[model samples]
Target chain A: MKTQKFLLTEQEMPRKWYNIMADMPTPMEPPLHPGTGQPCGPEDLAPIFPMNLIEQEVSTDRWIDIPEEILDRYAIWRPSPLFRARNLEKALDTPARIYFKNEGVSPAGSHKPNTALAQAYYNKVAGTKKITTETGAGQWGSSLAMCCAFFGIECKVFMVKISYNQKPYRRLMMETWGANCTASPSTETKAGRSILEKNPDSPGSLGMAISEAVEEAVSDENTKYALGSVLNHVMIHQSIIGLEAQKQMEMAGDYPDVIIGSAGGGSNFAGLAFPFARDKINGKEIDIIAVEPTSCPTMTRGPFAYDFGDTVQMTPLLPMHTLGHNFVPAPIHAGGLRYHGMSPIVSQLILDNIIRPEAIHQLETFKAGLTFARSEGYISAPECNHAVAMTIREALKAKEEGKEKVILFNWSGHGLVDMASYASYFKGELADHDLPQEQIDAALKDLETLPKPRQGGK
Target chain B: MSTFSTAPPSDDVQVRCPRLGHQVHFGYCRAENLGSPCFKALDCWYLQFDVVGYFKQTLSGADFAAAFVHQGRPKMQTLVDLIQQAKQGTPEEPSGPGKGSA
Candidate 1:
């Protein structure tokens, strides 16, 4: 009866991903090599990444064309539906029109495949035999595994230990797709061994997982490493989400007044909001929000600096919002949102004051997730609850202000696989974990121990 | 990946590789190590995977994005097997034990 779903045909999918690097207000600081303390060049990354992806990582081109092969694979699930949340609106009793891009329909059940397919396609073309990567909650690993299956490449996923146990389905999904999934801190890599030695009962962190994945990818000539979020290229591939939203919103005869998505490593939020962020940079009136959990408040409490991306100091120094890399996050149910850093692009945008980052507690996020699942009829992944909570917050604020507003967010994926989190929530086993300021300060203090960012290396 | 219980040099002991269950020296394979040892896989998935040696020496940062980082996918089969769908409970009601939120 009402205009509910805006659908796009395969042919209608955008051909090029929007790159925010070309439009950033401030030039980004180049990533530095760990050993040299100098800016890393393409050859330095040649070991772990194909040259094609390395180019995409550093490309400042406003629009980079998507390879036909990648687009063909994307046709399987591209042009995911954009829906106006009529039920959610009625439940909120607000005048705001809420819209969400459904990314759960992919084979991997998340926006991760948007890049996984792309990464797999490029590596396949590059004659790469396999990809090694890390996952916090298993979404990216399985997505990559499925992409590798389609492309006839091999995949290895190092899933964080806590999530490996919490979400059994995540590991099974990866294994079913033929990717090897393992628990971190298993004494497989030098990094993992060192960590296990120090704390035998360590619940592995994303930082440790990255170290393990990078070690394997770098040591093998035929394998390369792929990351799910927080990097320039991963976010670039995810632009398909936001680009599609732009066209879909026009079909609904509306544009978002405020845009939001949960930020773990920042890819999903970047995927659904960066295209709009481009419009905002060009003087469009829009509010872009990146939400994260209070348990691991990298953006809200972390500093904007050049920091290592992993714990064992095996990765390069990226300019991002970080609580120190050595800081281990509290084991929150939103396992995907449990990192110590934000994406470099996201950090730079916040520095330029273009994107607004918000932090929500675990219990409130669970409440928001439950609210949406009951009304909208789709369970959300725990990580996505952060955005849903913020969207509801914005909608209620609109009502209190007596103003009609358009609220948009990425319903990044469904939580059916993560029902364990909800089960824990219903059982009252999950609690809001707020990192005290003292811990945040101590973590930031650890950054002082690392080599500083290049003073003038623009 | 190997099952030969060779002792590791130094503190790095060879444990079962989480992916394939092979007895790999600590840190021998990243996916095997960085993965959740909080749980373990059944076998060593890639034991003789030897194209591994050809890749150039790993640069100090995995080239830079893989380290002192902060915290940070999905897929699946049908409705019944993966996980128990939230028992169809009302969101407002507290079913679990403990301090329920107001």
Candidate 2:
């Protein structure tokens, strides 16, 4: 019988996360302070994050040790299987050997828990009694909730009001994990109150939820805030995915020639690709692709520029990042890849030519999801579909080339919680939407007036 | 905000909101953020119809600029802004149920 899945014992799990900070061909520009316009120091972030994590955020170390307690907790789902997609290869009838690291087996049903658990543990040791975070689709919220339960820390999730109502099951999952989930703009904090005062019926947004969560964390001394992705520390924590993949690939007696993962805020892709990226940086021939929705196009279309972190232009300008200035938001079901900007680390890597970015349409991703489900019998999350879609594209390309290529991708999560998207796809309800060229041109004209970031500023 | 109704031709046209991750109507996207069209409305709805043209025809230049061109901040900036705002908390204490988590 063919060995379908590559397994690693708990003892084989990578103990230290591979940090890409020490490696970059060029050091990344530091995040600046909004008010001071100087590189933001630990004190600025200290208000919301623990000092330990803040240290991790700015650390240049190539390797960071995973705490034993965190490892003990990870034992529940650590060493996730690396599967050889024999069925998918057969279905495609391609010469490419396809493989996927299944991150869906985690308690939260996604790779999000990789960072969530680490954040929760750090917060717990930092004497934080509670952690506050905002979630759009409840993936991060539920993951944090479960980790907080494991760490005995109170988890308060300010979920976007629309998703809070639309995804009640996700909210229930948070509640079941002993986390308190509230509909954002729900009159809980001043931020929520201000929005409610303006529009009583306002279906809240992720921005509104972040405002509320940050407010709650600030008002309490014992509370700290957590962000699921797009931060350096989050990337550091997520490298475990790639580190483990490396060991499992060795066990399978094969190395991937191509590595793919979907990039929303770029953490999960960085999770699976950064360690492999080290190899690519050191003269190894590997194609690392970060797949994003065509609508968002943070890396694929947007030019490298300094842009304000928020729409309000309050945050300091982030350098070497693609401003999602011309977002055409094609209303794809891949909700996670919709973040306005790519992570600074991921952005810098792109600038240095260490990573490649690709964008695909909504229909292509959904179609690839269906093909994967039919072949592998595992329905993937809408976000995961982007990677699968890109993987299939590469496989077909290899077939046409008549080259025996090895491909690996991160199966970031399962789509069980996101069946509504599938229902929409099956019912032919999903449609493409894009911005008019005139509108994009008009918007870009105004963006010129904004402050440009200093190249590699101190 | 002018009362010129920026309603879509058909209220039935719907698309999944990238931000919210669910189906929302053209009506909802147009007036998503307290009477203003979502900043991403033009970006999200142009393919369905002449969304940019419709808004250009219906809205004042100021309103139009506010909606699409001046879309809100990125997620990180919002957190930084909130921390500053929370530090300068207004006198009013939050009147709500206690913290919800265990």
Root-mean-square deviation of every model: 14.0, 4.7
Error of 2 at A438 (Å): 7.3
After superposition, candidate 2 runs with Cα above 4 Å error: A308-316, A323-329, A433-458, B1-9, B69-72, B90-102
**TM-score per candidate:** 0.75, 0.91
Candidate 2 C-alpha lDDT tens digits along A1-458: 99989999899989999889999887877766667778778887788999999999889999999999999989899999999999999999999999999999999999999999999999999999999998867888899999999999999999878778788988999999999999878798887888898888877766667778888888888999998887889999999999999999998899999999998777889999999999998999999999988765667766566764434565446663554454454445666676666777887788778889998888889999999999999999998999999999999999999989999999999989888888888888776544345645664564676766444323
Interface RMSDs of the predictions, in order, are: 20.1, 7.8
Which DockQ values do the candidates obtain, in the order shown? 0.04, 0.26
What's the lDDT for all of these models? 0.69, 0.80
Mark the regions of model 1 whose C-alpha exceeds 4 Å error after superposition. Answer: A159-167, A182-212, A307-317, A324-331, A433-458, B1-102
> What is the Cα-based lDDT of residue A336 in candidate 2?
68
TM-score of model 1 (first chain only): 0.89
TM-score of chain B of each: 0.23, 0.69
True contacts kept of 1: 0.05
Q: What would the per-residue lDDT of candidate 1 be over residues A67-180, giving only the tens digit for each residue? A: 888888999988999999999999999999999999999988889899889989999989999898877557778899999999999998888676677667878999999998
Candidate 2, after superposition: displacement of residue A147 in Å?
0.3
